[model samples]
Target: MLLIRNLIYWLLVAIVTPLFFLGLFIGAPLPRRTRHVIGESWARLLTWLLWHVVGLRYRVIGAENIVKEPAIICAKHQSGWETLALQEIFPSQVFVAKKELLWIPFFGWGLALTNPITINRSDRANANRLMLEQGTNRKQHGFWISVFPEGTRTRPGVAGKYKLGAARMAKQLDMPLVPVAHNAGEFWPRNAFLKHPGEITLVIGPAIYPRDDVGPEAMTRQAEAWIEARQREIGGVGPFAHPDERKARTA
Candidate 1:
């Protein structure tokens, strides 16, 4: 049954993608509301196809937190499932994804219509610059931007240190920050297409926006501190930094 579902999932991905792109381009000359409806309609279509065709059930939380205000979302990176799942969380979200994703067969090209912030991961310097510039642009456009701070996934029990990309973007833009942690990797291991059934709980914390008197460094430290503490309180597993160090982080 799982194999059959996977087959249908792949087929749906292949079939609906071109129709999505066609709707995007041909529907562009329509009103802004119409275009937004088209884009959202495509999101819903893909979600429906994936759910009915694939046995994978998707669940999202904290939708109420950022529904009104745009933010920089810092989430734990696990399987590519998070990427697709994020669409269901906020169909209006503009992601900071790897530049290579744009080269992917169908979905990548389809994503280009949404103005996602794609970074060149091969070059650290270039990627950071793009992150900062694009972060501000998307924030100004009233769209939430999600960044997987790990840059890549880790095994279930081996999650690594949190990267500073999402924090840097939040601080630079002086926007509200939201941290979401999930245990998706235990079910969807990296580089493996087989997905096991499990509860992928996405926890969204309070939004953190910098104070007028505080600098980016200070604000980032605070954001990190808050999340690290919450993770431990919730009995988070994997590699975690010292709570004190996170709170006192200046660099």
Candidate 2:
């Protein structure tokens, strides 16, 4: 049954993605707000497909922690799920993604239209410079920036080293840093075919205001502690789980 549902979900993607891409071109030459609305609409459609086609549901805890004003959203990277869900959750936000993603055909063009902060991950120094430079400009224009501190998707029960780019951008811009933790990979394993039907819990922590004396590394450490602790509380299989054991569970 799960396999059938997953097939249906991908079928839906195949049908809808091209249409969304066409809409992107139509919205081109219009204002950035117009393109953003189109992108948000596509995200909402995909989120709905995830629920109806795949039987996956989600609930956001501490949504009130999400302020209306522009701030940095630091979220866990697990599956492709958050990429769609976050767009629906936070409207008119820019994501910090890799430069390679911008080279894709239709999806990449749409992403570029949204004015995301694309970085070449290979060059650490240049990436930081771009994040600080472009991130500040985006924030000044009242756009929220969503960054994945781990940089790439990590399997459930695994935690990646938290990067300090988001923290630095927050401090540089003097914005509130909102940390997010979720176990989405438990249901939607990275690079896996089957997506189990389950209610994913996304917890948003309180805004951490960076102090003048506090540096990015320190601020990131503080956020990392809270996020990792919260991950365990929300049913993350800790590092103690063996690789084979984890694989069997996913299988």
Candidate 3:
């Protein structure tokens, strides 16, 4: 049943994607906000299809933690789920995604229309510079920046090394970082075709302000600590969990 549902959902994605891409050309002559709205509509539609077609639902905790001002979102990257979900959560936002994603066809074109901060991951120095430059510009224009601290998706119960790019941007721009933790990978495994029907919990932790005395490394550590701790509290298995800790948990 789950496999059939997943296939149907993917079929819907294949059918709807090009139609959504047309939004890019249709919205090109309009204002930036208009283009964003068109992009957001596509995201919202996809999210809706995930729930209705795939039977995968989500619940967000601590939504109030989302502040009014633009912020840098430091989130756990587990699967592609959060990418679509975050677009619905934040009003005006841009993701710091890989430049390679822009090469993909209709999807990449749609992403380009949204003006995300794309980086060539092969060049670390250039990528950092571009992140700082473009991230600052996007923030100034009132677009919240969503960055996955791990830089790539991690499997469920696995904790990837958190990078300092988002932290540096937060410190340099004096922006508050909103740490997000979720157990999405448990149901939607990374690059998996089939998704389990379950309620994925997404917890939004309070914004961590970068301290004047603290370096970006310290800030990254602080956010990582909060997110990891919260992930455990929300029943997410951590990669470093003790053998005893894993044994004691209820299934």
Candidate 4:
């Protein structure tokens, strides 16, 4: 049943993705807001399919934590699910993505229209400079910046080394730093073909306002602690399961 569901889901994605890319191209000459709406509409469609076809669902907690102004969002990287899911949850937003993503055929072409702050990840100094500069510009244009501080996705119950880029960008712009945690990897395991049926919980922690006394390192640490602790609370099986419970079950 899982195999059947996954096969059907992928088939739908394959058919629908290119169609949306065409829409993106048609909307390219329009305002950034129109192009963003076109792009995010695609994300909304895919997330809807995940719930209806794949039986994967999600619920957001602490949504009230999201403020009205443009800010920096630091989210845990778990699976591709968050990429699609966050678009629905947040307002007009752009991601801090690697430049290589703009090279992909249809999907990448569509992403390019979204006006993301694309950086060459290999050069840390250059990337940081560009992130702050472009992030500030985007914020001024009323776009919230979403960053995966881990640089890459990690498995469920595993904590990735949080990078300070998001914190630095927030501090540079004096924007609120919002931390997000979720258990999507538990159901949508990274690079896994089969997406299991489950309800993923995404928690948005309170905004950490940049302080003159708080440096990027300290801000990053605070966000990491909150995200990782929330991950443990929401995690179900595998490493997220209580050690004593697993031991007793094995015994």
Candidate 5:
């Protein structure tokens, strides 16, 4: 049954959706918003398909606090699920990710159309410079840019260090920093082929603004601490809790 669901979903998704996008790109008079709407629907449809295929479901909390702002999203990157899910929920999203992801087959081409803020992961100084550049550009373009401050996906119950990139962008752009947290790893963890049946909660807190007196270090710490607390409230240990894992029981 699961295999059947996966097959049908991917057959339509992998073949039909891109073909539709291609058709629209060629001669169709579809507006950019229309294309984005179709992409959003596709994300939700696939998410539902995958859930039913594996009998997995999830919930979100405090999503109301997220406003449509020209701001930076300091998200906790745990598993790749929330990235697509967030963009689906908010179609005007401008994702600032490592430029390496541009190599993905279908997705790479799609993002180029919207012109996302891609950064070179190879050069540290260069990447930071590029981050600020793209952040400012996305702001001017009126796209809400999301930055995963953790830099990389966290192991279940293990939070990675918060980088200064997100804060720097917020300061440079003078935009509020919206903090997003999700307990996705318990269900769709990093490098796991078999997705498990569980509830994944995406809890988005309100935007955190930089104080007139504080520096980047202060902004990073506050955003990191808030998300970490939210993660703990959802039943797992805080991101800092590497406190001796008991073999990580797959949820």
Candidate 6:
């Protein structure tokens, strides 16, 4: 049953994705924000199809916590589901995605139209510089920046290292950092062909504004603590700890 549903969903996706790509190109001459509207519409459509066709639904907790101003979002990376769903969850936003995504065929071209902060992960210094430079510009243009601090998807019940990039961007820009938590991995596990039918709970933590006295590492720890705690409550398996603490234990 799950396999059949997933097949149907992907078939529909194969039909819809390219059509949206055409829309993206047609809107390419428009302003970045306008192009983002078309892109987000594509994401929203896929999210709707996921619920109706794949039987995987999601509910957002603390929607009120989403701030009015353009802020930085530090979200857990668990599955591709969040990639689509975050477009619906937040306002006009740009993602901090890897530069490799730009090389993909249709999807990459559409993603480029959204004005994401693309970074080459191998060059840490360059990635940070690009993020700060482009992130400031995006925020000034009223686009929230969403960063998956883990850099890539992690399995359900597993905790990935929360990098300081997002926190650093937020601190440098004096913007708010919002941490997000969800159990999307349980239903839509990474690299899994079939998605399980279930309800995914996504929690949006209150905004953590940057302080002159605090550094990115501390802010990153705070975000990680809140996100991981919520993960355990929602459905994640146990023994979550910060990367530093885990290292300290071994040392």
TM-score of candidate 1 relative to the true fold: 0.75
Q: By lDDT, rank the candidates, best first.
A: 4, 6, 3, 2, 5, 1
* Prediction 5 TM-score vs. true: 0.81
Q: Cα lDDT of all candidates, in order?
A: 0.65, 0.84, 0.84, 0.89, 0.71, 0.88
lDDT for position 167 in model 1:
70
Residue 130 of model 2 has an lDDT of 77
Residues 197-241, candidate 5: write the lDDT tens digits: 567778888888867798888998988898988876664532323
Model 4 deviation from the true structure expressed as Cα RMSD, one decimal place = 2.4
User: Which regions of candidate 5 fall more than 4 Å away from where they truly are?
Assistant: 1-12, 20-35, 236-251
Give model 6's TM-score versus the native structure. Answer: 0.92
- Per-residue lDDT tens digits of candidate 6, residues 1-251? 88999999999999988898999999899998889998999899999999999899999999999999999989999889998999999988899988999999888888999999999978976777777889889988999999999989997668899899999999988899999999888788778778878888899999999998999999999999999888777763213333443454466
The local distance difference test score of model 6 is 0.88
Q: What is the C-alpha RMSD of each candidate to the true structure, in Å?
A: 6.7, 3.5, 2.7, 2.4, 4.1, 5.1
lDDT of 3 by residue, 1-251 (tens): 87899999999989887887887878887776778888888788888988998888899999999998899999998888899899998768999989999998877877887889999978987877888889888887889999999989886566799999899999988899999998888777778788777778899989988888999999899999999887776654433233443555644
Across 42-68, the per-residue lDDT of candidate 4 in tens digits comes to 899999999999999999999999999
The digit string of per-residue lDDT tens for model 2 on 1-251 reads 88999999899889988898898898899877778888888888988988888888898999899987898999988888898898877747899989999899877888898879999978987877878899888887788999999989987667899999889999988888999988788778788777778788889999989898999999999899988877776653423233554555566
lDDT of 5 at 181: 79
Poorly placed runs, candidate 3 (over 4 Å) = 236-247
Error of 5 at 124 (Å): 3.6
Assess candidate 3 and give its TM-score to the true structure: 0.92
Candidate 5 deviates by what RMSD?
4.1
TM-score for all models, in order of appearance: 0.75, 0.91, 0.92, 0.93, 0.81, 0.92
On TM-score, the leading prediction is 4
Quality of model 5 by C-alpha lDDT? 0.71
Better of 1 and 6 by TM-score: 6
Candidate 5 — which pairs collide? 159-239
